[model samples]
Target: MKNNLYNFTDKSGSFISFSAHRIKSLYLPLCNEILMSSITADLHGDIKSGQNSFLMEPASRADLSLSKSSRNFWVYVNKDQVWSAAGVSKNI
Candidate 1:
């Protein structure tokens, strides 16, 4: 593998999730219910650590520096998935 190469995968969730509570004023009961209901059966069990299924927050340089254990959960957003949701891509 070469440097600068980013093989982003679910093994490493979102760094922004750390600041989940900072951005409030929304509702997410459905997500919490679904997650709790399917804990043992869920593929990624550790996701519930921070319990932030739909939280988005701005991260500072210090926040991003946190260790792996400090993270909430790992999220995998791949190219194929992106293109599928966004339709075909155009060449530059």
Candidate 2:
């Protein structure tokens, strides 16, 4: 089965999209949380690489946790919300 495609949008009406293959190549174990973290890291790296600020706004609570690492920037959607993480990636 083909992996799901993910889209990232900024507040300035600009957006970039990526396929699961692209994500997998960058980050091992393409699980949802890992993918989200990968996306945030990639985005942050892109911004830092360009010497610009990185900003992310996840549409849902599930998408927000990827940025939780101390190495990454974290922006939570809500304090009382919770989400069950999905399956782990089998292909390492």
Candidate 3:
């Protein structure tokens, strides 16, 4: 959990930081949210993943439909309007 495959850090090693608290409290939850939501779609027979994902967009936290055009990807949507959250898949 200390290291991640995803480039959550800056290459120049400046202007950004992945503190242990951030990774555990923020980053990991986001990645997990994608998995949770994908599970929701998969239950209905639509598999979503990196290969079938979307670019992050300012979509409704509860918005449905993952789209793509020769470059499919899931949008990293926020979980709620009042406060940003993860584990939104449970709502779907």
Candidate 4:
């Protein structure tokens, strides 16, 4: 059974709907609402992890890493900066 649902939108403003069950077998836990919702809710407020800032060119060179756990959470960063938003790119 599906634990969640997703409605995807493209840059053109078009959207498509799909059942999470379709991909659940692949073991993509990000589709699980119980897990996803908790992670999202926890990211709110004054938590340092939720606060994101841009790093300049020199600062960008410092070794940066993210845990698999954090990779599942929503985060926004400047595309041109060291840490980038999940799927955004500077060229876009």
Winner by lDDT between candidate 3 and candidate 2: 2
What is the overall TM-score of model 3 with all chains considered together? 0.15
Which residue pairs overlap in candidate 1's backbone?
Answer: 13-74, 13-75
Give the Cα error of residue 58 in candidate 3, in Å. 2.2
Give the Å shift of residue 9 in candidate 2: 13
Tens-place lDDT digits, model 3, residues 1-92: 54452344567743343343332212211245454232122121122444456454333323323332112334455755232132233343
Off by over 4 Å in 2: 1-15, 20-22, 27-70, 82-92
Write down the TM-score of every candidate.
0.17, 0.20, 0.15, 0.15
Question: After superposition on all CA atoms, how large is the RMSD of candidate 1?
Answer: 17.1
The candidate that wins on TM-score is 2
Deviation in angstroms for 39 in model 4?
Answer: 11
- Model 2 is weakest, by summed lDDT over 10 consecutive residues, at 44-53
Q: What is the Cα-based lDDT of residue 89 in candidate 3?
A: 37
What C-alpha lDDT does candidate 4 achieve relative to the native structure?
0.29
Model 1, C-alpha of 44: deviation from truth (Å): 25
The better candidate by TM-score, 1 or 3, is 1
Clash pairs for candidate 2: none
Q: Given candidate 4, what's the lDDT at residue 12?
A: 78
Query: Over 4 Å off in model 4, which ranges?
Result: 1-27, 30-80
What count of clashes does model 2 give?
Answer: 0
